[model samples]
Target: MTTQRTETTTLWRPTGPEELALVAASGWRAWPPRLPEQPIFYPVLNEDYAIRIARDWNVPASGVGYVTRFEVETEFLARYPVRRAGGETILELWVPAEELDEFNRHLVGEIQVVREYR
Candidate 1:
């Protein structure tokens, strides 16, 4: 008998350079810790959702935003199912702030910049 292995890959996030710095300063390997008042870290599932947030929310507040791509272990993603909100293909996953370190451990490689929003 052969067992099939699940190979899920690719996750994305959008943020301003300042925010990206937080991740970069940590060696471009993982997301940074959340602020005390912050409760969850959201990594969207699709480029569109990430782009929208980067363009709509991030740019307005920070004057610029970026869309980043990364990979995560499939099994880790299975732990958090995709979520949709208000009919958008949000493809969002909410990782509790406290669990971010564990989540980062699943990243397959360096985070990359796919595009920028301004």
Candidate 2:
């Protein structure tokens, strides 16, 4: 069987040239002992805030059941929504396996938060 490779655009960046929001990511991908890409990101803030974020992006929480604290830079990011760095309503969503391929077809990258601790 072939695993349907898809680009999961889990990060939702709202309108405007918003400042990047820091993100830390750990997931159930290849090389379980480590991460594949830069485990840090600064995408715009979405809706889910913390709990929802953990569900979609964090490795510990991606499975059938688990809890992880992924948002470490919330206070800092909330500072500049209208200033130099605008923002978005950060949210973590699970797209249907089929749409994953075209979810962020034109997007660039994932929303990976910085390395953090629970």
Candidate 3:
């Protein structure tokens, strides 16, 4: 018998450019840990959701925001539940603060900025 390798899928995360800078500082391999006050890392399912957060919340609050795209192993994604918030089209993956390192291990490649709001 043989075990098959799980394929990876793409996901988007919206954050301030400062946060993205932190990711780059890590050598483009993983995300920085969530802030002390942040309990979860929300990686959304669609670009629309990411863009909205970047544009509406991050930009308004910080003057700059970015939408980042990356790939995650499908097998790892099974460990958590996806959640919906704000509206029907808004969906996100809830990565607990403790599980973030494991989540980072599943990232397939560099996290790239797909869009930016300033």
Off by over 4 Å in 2: 1-48, 51-94
Per residue, candidate 2 scores C-alpha lDDT tens digits across 19-111 of 121122212111111123424233333434443434444434333222222222233333324222323544333333343234323333434
RMSD, model 3, all Cα superposed? 2.4
lDDT score, residue 100, model 2? 29
lDDT of each: 0.86, 0.31, 0.90
Worst 10 residues of 2 by lDDT: 14-23
TM-score of each: 0.89, 0.26, 0.92
Superposition error at 62 for model 1 (Å): 0.5
Model 3: per-residue lDDT, tens digit, 18-51?
7888999988779989888989989999999999
Winning model by lDDT: 3
- Candidate 2 lDDT (Cα, 0 to 1): 0.31
**Residue 8 Cα positional deviation in candidate 2, in Å, after optimal superposition:** 15
Question: Candidate 3: which stretches are off by over 4 Å?
Answer: 1-6
In terms of TM-score, the best-performing candidate is: 3
TM-score order of candidates, best first? 3, 1, 2
Clashes of each: 0, 18, 0
lDDT of prediction 1: 0.86
- RMSD for each of the candidates: 3.0, 15.8, 2.4
